[model samples]
Target: MKKQFNRMRQLASQTVGRAEKTEVLSDDLLQIERRMELVRLVSHNTHKRLVSCLQGQVGTDSEKRHKKLPLLALCQTMQDGGAQLGDESLIGKMMEVCGQAETTLASELMEHELQIERDILEPLYQLAEVDIPNILKQRKQLSKLVLDYDSARTRWYQATKSSNQAMAAKVDSLKDEMEEALNKVEICKDQLSADMYNFSSKDSDYASYYLTLLESQADYHRKSLAALETAIPNIQLQQGQMGGPTTPPPPITPLNSPARELTSTPPPQRNGSVYLTAGTPHSQGGSRGPSPHLMRRGRSSLHVPLKGDPRGRPRIRWEDDISKLALGRLGIPQDEVSSLLELFPSRPDS
Candidate 1:
């Protein structure tokens, strides 16, 4: 009985020792699980703190990458330092470091983008509002100036037209007056020719007297021819000296001075009028008489009088008539006659 009791006691003691060993193993496992849980909690808290710091210090890119990380994986990484680490505390420190680095890089990139926008966009907007509007207003003002210039040019053209028309009207009026005066000159020339023809029909007793008158008339014509010849060189010399037209020579007087024997006879009466002799007595007792034959032939021969010589019969004033005709026909002002004559070629006397 003693031996059986000793065996059972030994078995019971062995069983009790095994159970206590199992309980101690179970307690160590629970303590280990609690330690792991604490490590995980501590790692998760550290990662969250790191992430929050990155969000505040850095910017969006880190937050976006962090959102992709699984909560369990992130926790495991935090507790173990990395996938290679079995230590929880080390893993937690590594995860916090990675989150902080990502935040810093994102913050630098955002700042760079902000600086680029400031450099490029701000000046462009200002140019659009201020410079572009000023350019448009300048173009509009130039258009208005062009329009005003065209209007002023049109007015200048109108004024020039009106002035030209007035000048033309005055010229036409001057032309009409000239034409009327020319007609009167022609009538005077015709009457002088008729009177000369009537005087040529007188008797032969007047032939000797008419012959002397012819000689005197021929002498006067010769003098006129000589004077005309002398005038040509004088005019050229004067024009060369003055570089312009010269003033016209004064008109010569045409009063006749007969010889002493021709002036002594009395005057005759014919056709109910007293006919003065070719040479007749002057009031100073100077003899002046023109013979009967002289009177008839002289009337026939004398075609025109000299200029400014009204003392002679009006029939002989052909040069005076020509000046009047030139004034009437050519529309030259009387004051400008000397200048107009300069344009004519010098003529030879017949």
Candidate 2:
């Protein structure tokens, strides 16, 4: 209880002395403390905001099975939707490539955020929560000790000036207390000054950490830009096709159309031969060839009676392919092909 009262008294005295501008804090130390306090406040808030951004940009593990950036999630959704639309769809193809680019961007962004957390946010947090706070606590302890030393000195001086000799022992004890308090104040002041100088020395390092963050941010934007630049032209090309003309399909012909009959008519026969004249035979008449009755039959017209064999006896011979010659002349139906063959006897060579 006595210790608590003394602590309260010392705090009150220190507060009054500081307010009256009589506490006499070192100018450099005061400036360092003030700057450290600001750093702690700003950095702590920055850390909080960065963490919040991470949670929002990339969902927490509990919120998402595989913590994905918001854009990554969107890209995945687009990719799946594109696949569902099938390979031939133009929009589907564009979505496929766009989603791939966005996926790459999302991955890069996630990497950047993680790097920031590691290099910037984590260090800021340490400065705010640990390093600066420890230094400030030491400053506060030093302030209290200074107040205690002052109080001890005042008491010792009063005891020495006492008109009563009976107070000599009390004076000696008070002087001892004053000396011990001064020793503590000197020690704490030395430690606080050292910490302030150390903090000041690290100022450049803090600045460079922010520069590193900027570099990371610039690299991230470059990647994102490259991805978008590649995607935009393809998307534009697809967009341009929206109103262009399409080729019409070829005309379809009916299976039994007259046009087919016209096409089926044999082109005028050449040199009195049908498909081939290699083994064709001719009769004695040469030009007159087969009789009119046989000539009337398109299949028989294919036969040319040539001069007889060396023996001079007349012979009949037709093209090796009887069906081809008949069918090639008239558009003979497939079902009548067998009947036409029976009309022309098989060659003896068969």
Candidate 3:
């Protein structure tokens, strides 16, 4: 028993000592791992700082690529440590590009939704439904009203020989029809008011949607343009960009067509009156008139005033379309046109 007891005690001591030693070894191992991690982190930070400095110093594309290549390679080596070391710089750059693209796309989405509601759907809804059928029904009632009135009159005439009971019933029915027609008219008027309200509401909504769409488009364009301004270099304004003819073209005159004369035909006169002018009397006691050659239509044997017939002379004129046509061809301005009109001074006869 004593020997067994000693062996048990010794076994307990040996196990306890090994447990303490294991705990110590584990702690030492953890410390060595921590030192390794620190060394790795410091070396990587030093490399990063050196590359950043070199990139700052370098200007050539090849040198930049050389610096970038190692950075990309180092990311792969970051392994599980990436979560601890990687920052949000690249992520923020990516977000910046996405924001630019989304500005235009979001604008388009808003425009599309507005178009669907305002242009495509609302207009169709307005045109498709109506209270026209109710108006038609009212018209039908009005047509039947006339018949009811006539029938009631006939019934009353027939009832004069008998009792007036049936006649009174039909008369009452006719009155009911009249009241119904009035009621229908009132209903239609109320419906028209409602329709107007709906129409105005729809119109206002449609216009508002267009305004929103335009505003959104403007915002999108502003953002996109800002990005483009940053991305693209400014172009220098070149000289002589404004180009056109330095001098105006000369004005063109229009040609006139030949006029047809009716010299052989005598001038027909009605409402017996003569146009007179200052002239001498004829030797045969007949009246002499102003020279026909100076008057228009001389080719046609026309009436001549007795020379000094003593009434105010009527002014003669001719076609003046040629002058107007020339002015039109010249493309004259309003002020110049007024000046030309004054120069030409168109009369009622011409």
lDDT of 3 at 212: 60
What lDDT is reached at residue 335 by model 1? Answer: 42
Task: For candidate 2, write residues 1-350 as lDDT tens digits.
Answer: 65456556656766676322125368877888899989889888877877786633433333352255678788998899889986578778767877887877777777677677778887887888999999999988887777677777766776888887777669988889889988998888888899889999999987777788788889878988887898777766765575423455666676666788878876653332332222225666344334434534544354533333343223323333444655575544434544443444333331
- Across residues 194-307, which tens digit of lDDT does each residue of candidate 1 receive? 322332333242233325434544554565456546655654564445455456676553344345447656443222112223356678988565554655443334233333
lDDT of each: 0.40, 0.68, 0.40
- Name the candidate that leads on lDDT: 2
Give me candidate 2's TM-score against the actual structure. Answer: 0.58
Q: Can you tell me which runs of candidate 1 are displaced by over 4 Å?
A: 1-95, 159-350
The runs of at least 3 residues in candidate 2 whose Cα sits more than 4 Å from the true structure, single-residue gaps closed, are 7-24, 51-66, 164-166, 229-350
- For each candidate, what TM-score against the reference? 0.20, 0.58, 0.23
Model 2 misses residue 45 by how many Å?
Answer: 3.8
Summarize candidate 3's per-residue lDDT along 284-331 as a digit string, tens digits.
977665544423332122332223445524423112332243335543
lDDT (Cα, 0-100) at 261 in candidate 3: 37
Evaluate residue 79 in candidate 3 and report its C-alpha lDDT on the 0 to 100 scale: 34
Better of 1 and 3 by TM-score: 3
